[model samples]
Target chain A: MKIIAVCGMGIGTSVLLKMNAEKVLRQLGIDATVDATSVAIARESRDAQIILTTPDLVDQLQGLPSEIVPIEHFFDLEEITAKLSASLL
Target chain B: MASPKQLSNYPALAKAFADNSIRVGAIALDREHAIEMAGELLVASGRSTPEYTQSMLDAVAENGPYIVIAPGIALAHGRPSEAVLEIGLSLVTLAEPVVFGSEANDPVRLVLGLCATDHNSHIDIMAELATVLGDAESVNTVLNAVDSDQIRLLF
Candidate 1:
């Protein structure tokens, strides 16, 4: 699976979200490659299967090509897992 | 992102916080004050310029498209611009939590400001910061830290 973790400027929170997404995907026995990028860049990304991001960016992702998963807390592993469990399959 | 294959740099981040990046036990009248103080720390360290600080405030006013990442924690930053002098991080632990107007998370206690020469440079820092912030115990330790020096030790 191709996943992209996105945020405003592509640096801080998105990196964290990407790390957690990859970790959760691995722990759930899923195989996926995740990319971290800015929301502007993420909008143009066509190949990603899932776009894991914060709630603030969910609206910006409207009409986009991927599944937009809005995470409430990027620091919570369990929350990321719970939100991603169904999507990975 | 910095490098997908690289491990998170907790130690280096710890050292960086110790040497050049922290302000703890601060009091802010509101979220903007908290953000400004956090941004100023980076500016004083030469990591960011005054315009970057103002931009941060503007971003928050624009409704924090990315600042509030978790409950009680907000990370403030802007696009890589001339406002940034170099890549740096600054942390502020507010004595009084202030609301940033998030439904799930509000009354933030920690405000982290990041400035990068480019977007990619701070991705590694974020990875490390996430490691520390991800753990509830560490976040608690950070909140309880007496000063900037102690917070660096916790990192």
Candidate 2:
């Protein structure tokens, strides 16, 4: 599965999330490709199956093909993994 | 500039983000100017100049809202050289909603301005700020703050 961690800059928190997601996927024995991108670029990145971001930017994503996961705390790796797992199907 | 502990206070937070070179304030204006305002504050803090401010704003404008960094807070910043002489912070509160390209679960209220001299240093500060913002109570306290001194005590 492919996941894209989206945020304002796509450099700091998004990169952190991508690393945690990779670790989580490894622990779950699921092979996944996790990438980080800014919200603007994310809108056009069709390669991603899921987009993770905070709640405030949720509304801005209106017609994207990827499913959106709103993360309240970017540091909550477990929560992020859980949400990603449930959305994988 | 103030220490991270002192930055916990509102006034200190404001002043910490400020320097003789940077101008910070609470502005009740249109949301479109959010980036502009943030840039001005950074410049006034003596971190950058108008050219740099404009570049940072342009980066965000091209990339969408880089403002929504925290839960309810937006940290508007760009490449260090876009407009930064040194690392600095600035704060601005909006009276109303400003569309900052966030998901439905989070809305932005407070804007923390960042002017970093380099990527590594910026990341360090960003990590620290993220840790502080992850605490719900602390963030709530900052949101509820009325005065700068009150903000200091909370930190």
Each candidate's DockQ:
0.55, 0.22
- Our model 2 lands, by Cα RMSD against the true structure, at 5.9
Task: For each candidate, give its TM-score against the true structure.
Answer: 0.90, 0.64
lDDT of 1 by residue, B49-89 (tens): 89999988876665363578899999888778898887888
Which regions in candidate 1 have their CA more than 4 angstroms from the true location?
B1-9, B18-20, B63-65
TM-score of 2: 0.64
Per-residue CA lDDT of model 2 for B33-150, tens digit only, reads 7667777877776877787777666666765554565456666667656456777776666655466665532456777667666545454455456555666877776676666554
For model 1, what is the error of residue B1's alpha carbon versus the real structure, in angstroms, after optimal superposition? 36
Report the lDDT of model 2 for residue A85.
79
TM-score (chain A only) for the predictions, listed in order: 0.95, 0.87
Evaluate fnat for each of the predicted models and list the values in order: 0.67, 0.15
Clashing residue pairs for model 1: none
Displacement of the residue B98 alpha carbon in candidate 1, Å: 0.5
